[model samples]
Target: MKLPYALAKRFVAGESLDQAVPKVADLNEHGIKVTLDLLGENVKDRKTADDTLQHYIELLEGIHAQNIDSSISIKLTMLGLDIDRDYCRNNLFELLDAAVKFNQFIRIDMEGTDYTQATIDLYKEAFKKYGKHVGIVIQAYLHRTKNDIADLAELGADVRLCKGAYNEPERLALQNMDAIREAYKEYLKVLLDKTVYPRIATHDNKLISWVKEYTQEKGIGKSRFEFQMLYGMRLNTCKALAAEGYNVRVYVPYGTMWFPYFTRRLKERKENIWFVLSTMFQK
Candidate 1:
């Protein structure tokens, strides 16, 4: 593996849980919460998926034992969604049992368009049983996300809304920036109006400012929802929001199978490329 150790250090906590603890603690010290995502997905076999399930249970135990103020994010494929839906769901339920035990929360991370509906289906199934401790993410670029958000709103689901990271086709996703942002505006209203403590995930300054203004105009308290950003992208903004008494959470990802997540990070933002190059030269 051609590990871009520099970028990995920037975006991922580490390749192991032992290396992630301090990172999480530092964010907590700064008054920001965390949602730890163990970076692995699209598992093709049962043993690996089963191992993933077990590792998550261990992760929960470890976080609880360390007294970490962090929740976790899960990708269903990591738990075998691509292999079998029922098997994946069973794994999710088992992990939710651990979440219940520790009184921690788990947010299901949304993948590409192909996995969207099945992800939601499994999430709803999990929510029906362990709704209090489970949540899901939705992408703003997709045309179907409007309906997805409506369903989540009705369910009063705790959702994380992002502008999407997948390279979706034009027919299925909003290709123009203006169209995507407009869709985000409508989605935000529904999320704030009906969802339970939605997390708005974006690094766009205008969108961030707009969310502050929109929520304020609607009389929504700062504690009503959260502003979520990737772990290494916006520490200053996260701290500023925290200082302002707004709920802010950082999505901290770490694991040995981190290459996929790492590449996704670089592709998600042009700034990430510059971030890597700038930091590389600095070193």
Candidate 2:
């Protein structure tokens, strides 16, 4: 089925990099940084996986050639993690190599709990080799995050802290909203104290206020960290924060395979569901 263009516009940038670069330029013009994601994952064959790697290389080249102020995010499964571990590692290294040469950055995006450990492992190996040009994300809702943050912090890794979106059993994640919020607070503090450059990715006003207050109390400079949000969810808030002289980066995802990402964004807020459903019925 075709995705409704009106509904998809709120979350996805477009269906290809050609369509995405202009959007990136617009955001940059607004004084907000960006991370371009080529939306795809879970490939079933080596040929498709190799194609994903080539697309990423071209993406890096595109960013550099266009002089766009943005980084790129990649998923392991899209790069062959499911097909073969060794193949996945090689693919990651290939992207990292290109990123390093282009003087660009790559963010290793987290997936479900099943891929969590392997993703972290891949991040570690890549970081050890590529150094500061790469970063990884940690989900605050997971029970294992504190320890994970501690480990990554010791390596002085660049980390993006976000509340997870995947569905998992309570035994593995914090299910309650309040509990998750509190966990996010604690994780933010740890990231601030330990890591040099942590990206706080959230749309919650409470969390956003807390981050501001905590940074002020700690006397952390605005340049030391960044605030990250999705491409369309909190545009006003992101702009306000950027106006206040805070470094704000938007996660701009684009591509043809957008079902999983679009559905996940809709599930995060009931209003989003109602909006999409209402629009569909009205159409």
Candidate 3:
């Protein structure tokens, strides 16, 4: 026997905003913030893109109504980046407008290599117009990340640095584990030194320890930066960090398009699949 996807529902809030809202509210009660993500990508048409933007608008409104302490993370492709750049930009602006109305923030999530430049371009446009209300993600595994960080720093953008999930060629990305970790640490230093508020997104315990020590050594206050972890992957670690009075945000993704996202998680950490399977077989 193997664990059904339904069993993993404990990890995913649900497939809709209605289902996710309560879960996020509960996390807030425990003193943990959330970055809510409506999980879908690479929309094929303008209609779908508009619909996605509307869904986010409703999500923002729901969060506002509930008085939840959370922000929304969005993927450009879900806003029609692949269909048309201007169209995508327009869709993003709609969501940004909603965020502005609610006095909330929108985090632009980084995708694969093909969309990298466009994503950065969109972030630049948004940051210029909205400033701190917008933030972007940086993938440490990418070879160009150093330059990317430097450019983003010049804009004083808020950035979340993550060990990338996408698989890429050696020329474009760091394939070695140690190399990626080293790059992550270096990038962390650059972001912390230059950006307004940088986010370190990782689940590796050793790296988390290193970051705690480095930030303290650099005299960076716990409020200046945050540690981000995916929902359910490391609940205890997240709680411990929160208990220590450090900012910790859990990335909570919800939508019907969870298969691709779930598969990506499995591919990144194959052991997770075994854990799922074992859970399914348990009496």
Give lDDT per model, in order: 0.90, 0.91, 0.89
What digit string (tens of lDDT, one per residue) describes model 2 on residues 1-283? 8865667766889988888889899989889999999998899899999999999999999899999999999899999999989999999999999998999899999999999999999999999999988899999999999899889988888999999989989999999988999999898788888889899999999899988998999999899899999987888898899999999999999998888998998989988787677766663
Model 1 stretches astray by more than 4 angstroms: none
TM value for model 3: 0.96
Candidate 3, residue 81: lDDT = 94
Candidate with top TM-score is: 1
Which runs of model 3 end up more than 4 angstroms from their true locations? Answer: 1-10
Please rank every candidate by TM-score, starting with the best: 1, 2, 3
Residue lDDT tens for model 3, 11-105: 67788888888888887877889999999888998899889999999989988888888999999999999999998998888788888899999
Give every collision pair in model 3: none
Candidate 3 whole-model C-alpha lDDT, 0 to 1:
0.89
Q: Rate residue 214 of model 2 by lDDT.
A: 88
Q: How many pairs of residues in model 1 come into backbone collision?
A: 0
Query: What is the alpha-carbon RMSD of candidate 1 to the true structure?
Result: 1.2
